[model samples]
Target chain A: MIETTVFAMQVLLLVMGCLFFAVGTLGLFRFSDTLSRIHALTKVDNLGLGFIVLALLPLAPSLAGGLKTVLIWAAALAASATSAHLIARAVHVRPEPPEAKESADD
Target chain B: MTLILNAVAAFLLLTLLIALIRIWRGPAPADRMLASQLFGTTGVALLLLLAHAQAMPALMDVALTLAVLSVLAIVAFVTRVVRIDRPSSGRKAGDQPETHHD
Candidate 1:
């Protein structure tokens, strides 16, 4: 019974994680500007990856493996947040030439 | 359970392909960069799922490496591609005008 329950939970998590990732990418297509796209990618993908990590934790072969798995999530989160900020800062410091009719809102 | 995991992985890959469309068509460099970051996250998730599905522990290490490498790539972009100019002719601007190798 316990094993069956765990399996069900894992399936649920995996499905949810994939959907969240899809939505994050959807944001990229919907949003018009660079900063908005970053906003979507960072926030939504964080949840998506977090769900996948949670699903994998129970199946980890050892305590160390589980920790390593969690560590990957942490490292990715740090990288995403830091890189998003840096990219935004870069865009702010040196504004790019606005392409013609590129942005939806003037 | 394995079937579900595979289905989920397939969906994630589908989303990745959708993201690539934006990467190709994005107006600004930052937009492309953000899409690539999405790729990194999706790739990591896919790696973890693959590790679990295939019973391969070593692949998790590969995920960790990819996570670390993605950050390094962003750092390189910010430092090299994004030009940083010291505020010209203000406080400390006179100290040493910023210079770019290229």
Candidate 2:
């Protein structure tokens, strides 16, 4: 009974994670602006990944496998944050329009 | 148990697809960067799921490396922006008129 219950929980978590991921993707496609897309992608992606990882923990075959799973989760979180920051910075430094340049000179 | 993992993996794959769209159609460099970040996150998640399914411990190293590299890339990009925005030495090449010693 306990094993069955655990399996059910894992399945539930996985389904929820997938649902979140799907919604996040939809948000990306629906949003008009980059910032809005980022907002959707970051929040949903992070939570979705976290839940998926959590679901996998119980199924890990060995102690080492479990440890590794946790480590990957940690890494994902760090990488996601940094990558978002870089992308945002790149957008901010783009060249200004010709009209804006002319106005500045005037 | 395996069913759950499979479902989650499938979802992660979908997320990756969305991120790819963002990377390709993003309006600005920052947007692309954000997409890439999403890719990194999804990649790590996928790796974790795979490791669990396959019972492999070595794959975690790949995720760690990816995480570190992503951060390094962000730092480099930020520094580049700062350098570009800094004042350009505050002196012009053709400023002889302003240097009169009389």
Candidate 3:
């Protein structure tokens, strides 16, 4: 019974994570603006990943393996955030048409 | 159970691919930044799923650190943009209304 229960939980987590990931991907294509897209991606992405992590936590073979996974997650987040910021900054500084530009450009 | 986890990981990878598309086609730097953020999120999700399947705990700590750092990066970017866009005090001497109206 205990084994079955654990298996069930794992399945549940997998489904939930997939759903959120799908939503995040859809948002990437659907949003009209960068800011809006970011908002959508962040919401779904964070929860999706978190759920997946929680689900897998039980299966970790050893403490070392678990810690390694967490470290990888941290590194991924750092890279993503920094790259995004740099790209956004570049966009903000470039010369562009008035209509396509942010109000702050004035 | 392993199959289910594998499927989830695959889906997350797909999400990452979509985000890459966005980054490639992004009209502006901001758009690219948004796409990159998506990548980060998906990457974390993938790592977590993998760890779970492998039964690893250390990966969770990494995910937590990533979450915090990503948020900080966003905040920093916003502040930097705001500072850059701030209006300068360059009022023309003539534009300063003539005080001789008295």
The top-ranked prediction according to lDDT is 1
How many clashes (backbone atoms < 3 Å, residues ≥3 apart in a chain or on different chains) does model 1 have? 0
lDDT of 1 by residue, A1-106 (tens): 9998998888788778988898898898788888888898889998999999999888888899889999999988987887787778768776683454245323
Candidate 2 residue-wise lDDT, A13-86, digit = tens: 87777777778778777887776776777788789888887888887777887787777777777677655655
State how far residue A26 of model 3 sits from its true place (Å): 0.9
Docking class of 3: acceptable
- Fnat of model 2, as a fraction: 0.67
How large is the interface RMSD of each prediction?
3.3, 4.6, 5.7
Over 4 Å off in model 2, which ranges?
A62-65, A89-106, B80-102
**Model 3: DockQ vs. true structure:** 0.29
Task: For model 3, give the RMSD to the true fold.
Answer: 10.1
lDDT of 1 at B51: 86
Off by over 4 Å in 3: A62-106, B51-102
lDDT of 3 by residue, A12-51 (tens): 8878878888888888788877656666676677677667
Task: State which candidate has the highest TM-score.
Answer: 1
Judging by TM-score, tell me the better candidate of 1 and 3: 1
Tell me the interface RMSD of model 2, in angstroms: 4.6
User: In model 1 chain B, which range of ten residues has the least summed lDDT?
Assistant: B82-91
Would candidate 1 be rated incorrect, acceptable, medium or high by CAPRI criteria?
medium
